[model samples]
Target chain A: MEQTSILETRHLTREFKGFVAVDDVNLKIRRGTIHALIGPNGAGKSTFFNLLTSFLKPTRGEIFYNGQNITNMPPAKVAHLGMIRSFQISAVFPHLSVLENVRVALQQRLGTSFHFWRSTRSLDKLNDEAMHLLEEVGLEHFSRVLTVELPYGRKRALEIATTLAMNPQLMLLDEPTQGMGHEDVARVTELIRKVSENRTILMVEHNLSVVSNLSDTITVLQRGTILAEGDYATVSANPAVLEAYMGSSAHD
Target chain B: MSINRILFWFTLAVLALTAPFMVYPVFLMKALCFALFAAAFNLLLGYAGLLSFGHAAFLGTAAYLTGYTVKDWGLTPELGILLGTVAAGALGFVFGALAIRRQGIYFAMITLALSQMIFFLAVQMPFTGGEDGLQAVPRGYLFGFIDLNDNLSMYYFVLTIFVLGVGLIYRTVHSPFGQVLTAIKENEPRAISLGYQVDRYKLLAFVLSAALAGLAGATKTLVLQLASLSDVHWHMSGEVVLMTLLGGMGTQAGPLVGAVLVVGLQNYLADLGSWVTIITGGIFVTCVLLFRRGIVGELRALWKRSF
Candidate 1:
């Protein structure tokens, strides 16, 4: 156990009716680094992300955060501990304006999300901060538009902006660039690089280039377990990792 | 707000104020009460994405409670209405506690089942007076000073309560809490990831909505002086859904528009017995086919204003 490891999963396993999605795998996400969980389609990357966020409970495992056990804690409780997960699909409130989308998350930080009697106008002070988040993601110009109207690439950018509103210490981005043009992919890659400066990031990305460029450390999963864990230069050259990507069973 | 926005509400107020002079004031009072009921239902359906098929439970339960308090307990109109609203809220808490655990059509079914139980209880409960109802319940004096026994006074009193309920709903819709509820509706998992307790927010919306619906029901008791099975019946619950759907589920003015139209149609076509339900069903189907957003929602789409 490294002293800098902030998030640790011990024997994390998730089974869906006897079909094991995530096997007994230990994951330790170090502090202040961009970590990528890369795997083939159906390698249980999504399942692992869900388990870490407590969106899916582990069938047999324990999860810990900063030395505290968070195995059975709910998603909201996990998020309150400063971990946030983005969806593979661009997830933003469609009816709410982009500015309002970010503002909704920002309002949670102020502990005023429950004040039904108070006017949302009273929270106007949060607008500046929200706008700044949009600006960081190059979405300030589209802040007044409804989120549903945003282009696919811009929607991904908006999702990142909303996630940033939580001021999360650990950010879990699930395929942040799942569907985007080359231009959008680069733009978002740059945006992720900028936001990763102060926080720990756990991303499940399919794009090899995205994994190679953004990730400080990469854990290659094949058939629900880690095949190779190291920096890109080390993992990319590993025969087992090459075998997994080459469509051969790494276990064989 | 734009001039169209101002004109919209201003016109509505003027029509509401002057309608009693031209049409039957009693009919107007009935429309207003139903309008409030539909609006409350819309709070859960349109904004929170909750569909409770048993909303009549709150409305009917509150009617009986208000009727009991004013008629039997000799409470003032204000006290009766307050008690009814609170009782409905308490009922909402209990119902929401049970119902919020489920989602989508299942949630609706649970609520429907629960309301059916309430309906049966109303039919069997002696204090509710079963089919005979608590007839000739007094409107009593508002604050024991403004005698509501007069028809005109009662009309104005009911109108005031309607406006206040709508106004409170409007404020809630525009508030931070409303924003959170919308977020929850759009994506529950994402909302939870942002550290918001999604269930708690849903429950709050449910209770607020139930309490407002109860407020409408309580007022209706004063208007009609009767608490009966018709109020709590499953059909009444369906009727409110029809009103909201025809009006525009998410838009502010949709429920009121739907309520007024439904109420007006029933009043004018009272001579035609079963045709009213057929007409309502036809209207609902037409709205779903052409204007899925409802009348007000489509209008808002055209006008580019927040309804």
Candidate 2:
């Protein structure tokens, strides 16, 4: 009750041709909670994620961050306001060294994103801090390697590290461990736990163990509508949530 | 810098200074001018990954502006070049804005179409001398003091401008803005999610490339005293692309090496006329097939670094 809602959606609806991808959904994410969005494939989870980040414009909705309306804001501006998203797959600059990847995010934060004349090495001042963040994500050993050469799990770790460098008050991670081995999933889950300590995290996760382990709140959508919302135990016990998963699981 | 890099650059500087003494000054000047042009084109293509098929618009327009100002307005060579460069930057701003809204192949097509319109204007404009172009442009004094009429003085001036242009590009590529530009080139969606205004960076790069291309074109006019319709033709645009591709699309020194090879090929094959085009085409095919990273690019790979 004492917690504040940092991000809120007011009757968000997104229509694709004649199909409603998100049908009049409303959500209020608490200021500092690890929230998970779970849905079967084609249940409009990706579309909902896209609309929240402004990557897709909702046919009708209003998004508020803190108290400011962000439904009409561009993705970059939305990110600038401390809401940043990670891709469904790992997204890091393959040619850049891992250190440079984190440094670039920090460099943008320092207001030098448009400086064409300043030596990038001038950002050496951020080297210690960037390495510190890398170390936190268990990526310090791989700092000099090209991101493209990193293993799938490590690439996702680097994505988290880069996103962390943005100093986001709210982070949206889409399927952070989508295609990882069990060990990697554990490692990334731990990394997310560490990052979410002081920030609100909203992630779209299909991995149930990760979902149960990390999410303080779970949002389950079925065909563009909220089917269940609560803590893990309550939602898992819900008869309707079980039936929906059973229906999708049989076909999947 | 490593010792090898220092030695390489030192050798290059020495060669740049003394080559005119051994070679025909006019030929060397032409190569230097194009080296700058190709470098400018590479900034957009190599760094931004925006394949502009009509770079000649910037280069040719700058040349025409410089030629018209010197021949008609009686402006100093420096002022004429300044005007041309500014015009190219402005034009780049407009073109990049319109082009950046599209992605991949669409971006390339948009730029090509817009630059063709510029080509049409160049062919029809009275100031451009139509097909005749503005000719016999005065080189004028450097700051109204040093006479540039002397071929040796002119060679050094062109050489100096070439070095300055290359230096600008080098600094830009190594700069903070350049880092973000490459990020966009690598992954635009990630860049947007990271809060970078990717389109703005693309536009800035476009303007910078245009202005530098303008500088090269204006310098060419001073050296050759002509701005002709041939410069603005779509063929010129394709040639610049070929030069950059032959050099290495993204490497720092690729364009310079590519331009020299291209210009040298033209000079040696000049007596054969049409054979030159055929041979050039053959060389391009070979480069694309065998050394796709380009001559300098392949060399850089061997060296484990970019020149």
Clash number for each model:
0, 0
For candidate 2, lDDT tens digit of each residue in B88-137? Answer: 99999999999989988899889899989999999887778897888899
Model 1 shows how many backbone clashes?
0
DockQ of each: 0.83, 0.84
lDDT of 1 by residue, A75-154 (tens): 99888888889998888999899999999888976777788888989778999999999999999999899889999999
Residue B287 lDDT (model 2): 92
After superposition, which runs of candidate 1 have C-alpha atoms over 4 Å from their true positions? A248-252, B1-8, B304-307
The whole-model lDDT of each prediction reads 0.92, 0.91
Cα error, candidate 1, residue A43 (Å): 0.9
Model 2, docking class: high
Cα-based lDDT at residue B238, candidate 1: 95
Interface RMSD of each: 0.8, 0.8
RMSD of each: 2.5, 2.1
User: Model 1, residue A71: displacement in angstroms?
Assistant: 0.9
Tell me each candidate's TM-score. 0.96, 0.96
After aligning candidate 2 to the native by TM-score, how far in Å is the CA of B236 from where it should be?
A: 0.9
- Give one digit per residue, the lDDT tens place, for model 1 in B1-307: 5999999989988987777789888888999999999999999999999999999999999999999989999999999999999999999999999999899999999999999999999999899998898999999889889999887888889999998998889988889998999999998898999989899999999999999999999999999999899999999999999999999998888999999999999999888999988987887898889998899989988887654
